[model samples]
Target: MRNFNKNALNGKRAIITGGGGLLGPHHAIALVEAGASVTLVDINEKGLKRAKTKILKVNDSAKIATQILDITNLNAVEKFEALQTKHDTNFDILINNAAVNPKMSEIGGQNSGRIEDYNLNQWNNEINVGLTGAFICSRVFGSRMAEKNKGVIINISSDLAVRAPDQRVYSPSESFDDIKSYKPLGYSVVKTALIGMTRYLAEYWGHKNVRVNALLPGGVFNKQPEELVRNVSKRTLLGRWANLNEYEDAIVFLASDSSAYMTGQSLIMDGGRSVV
Candidate 1:
């Protein structure tokens, strides 16, 4: 039997969308540490800088690049792809990890949590960033990968993609009248849509050696309110939220040849939350 190569992605290149968000940098870190050159694309310049800083701290020699662009804009994405091709920097992996996750605490108003009162603009904005952005990036990057007859696309979905959010966790009291916070409907809808896209792309590019998959992660602990933490912990089988770095290895696995046979699948690493 041939031994597996530890540096499986030594010369591989990757592009990560929403590269400046909470999990984006960590995803970059995982790919960087695994020997892949990573380009992080995001609209927020500061977040991109911060993500680069965090990755540099982990490995100063890490091959990391950042770009400011809106993934929802197809023309912008196409232009970026053209520029990358000009520089001979074709990507071997694409991680569609961008999304807008609205916090209940940050939103305010009498009916903020009510679906009937959800702002149309907010709904459009969230879907544009979360679902549409994924579609755009996959089209721009995955197409090139298909032409080359090799690549991987990992959509960063959520555990909620498989299961509906238990809105009761966001409420302060058991009474329905006292409930003032509920998870946004767009979040679940967008995440679920990603799964469908993953399947479609997987088959579309399967003959060309391009593999597509989705990563369904659970909530990460980021200093949430005590009550909220407690409520979520009680429901999770692991009795706690995942650590920020917990998904790093999984990201590397999906990116590298280690998962060569895996395609058109959803890798749920939610501490068994979806099962329970």
Candidate 2:
């Protein structure tokens, strides 16, 4: 339950990709509470249901919608835009938050193995979901926003976008010959490229009043192993990972008029992990 400024986003509409993930619904709730209509899009239908239920508990009357969408597919994205039109919902914000993220302990299983042994299929899947997906959504949805000459696109990146993953944090005493748990190359590369996309789109659409920005958030606390938590805490200047709702206000700022003068920038809320 957050005390949001009721008029902050009055009459606005937002679309959040990866809306079924850990942080997406929180962003949706924050915006909805502030008087925006939000449509949650994700590939996971069950996750979408849970996310919608969670948001409804916060704002029972919130104008909410959901679509089982695969953002990686351009055709699917087009179909979603058509559906929104049928519903008379012309969105003003897009949150690119979908990515292939796995826990440190589960890294090896998620294709975070020694580079030489990394599976190309896994690498392609990561890129398609994290990078290509953003491109497709932006091309289809963002172009519409540009035509309207007023909109905001909030790209959800990560602290790893600005700083390389601390591989040491994923340390496990596995044999050199065995599949090691190194951070996947795709995660950092795709996240970093998102910032690049933000800058380019900001300039490309600035004249049309379409502002583009990115959020480079640190790890969120979600009961990871104690060892991993302690390691991350020691590395962060704030001495802890971010609370799940810590970035809510930041997300709202980026999605609303509060950041009217901001564009082509990234809001780094990483507990100072990149500093020291």
Best by TM-score: 1
| Residue runs of model 1 more than 4 Å from their true location after superposition | 1-6
TM-score of candidate 2 relative to the true fold: 0.94
> Worst 10-residue stretch by lDDT in candidate 2?
171-180
The alpha-carbon lDDT assigned to residue 47 of candidate 1 equals: 96
Q: Which residue segments of model 2 deviate by more than 4 Å? A: 1-4, 172-180
- lDDT per residue, candidate 1, 54-85, as tens digits? 99998899999999999999999999999989
Instruction: Give TM-scores for every candidate, taking all chains together and pairing residue i with residue i.
Output: 0.96, 0.94
RMSD of 2: 2.2
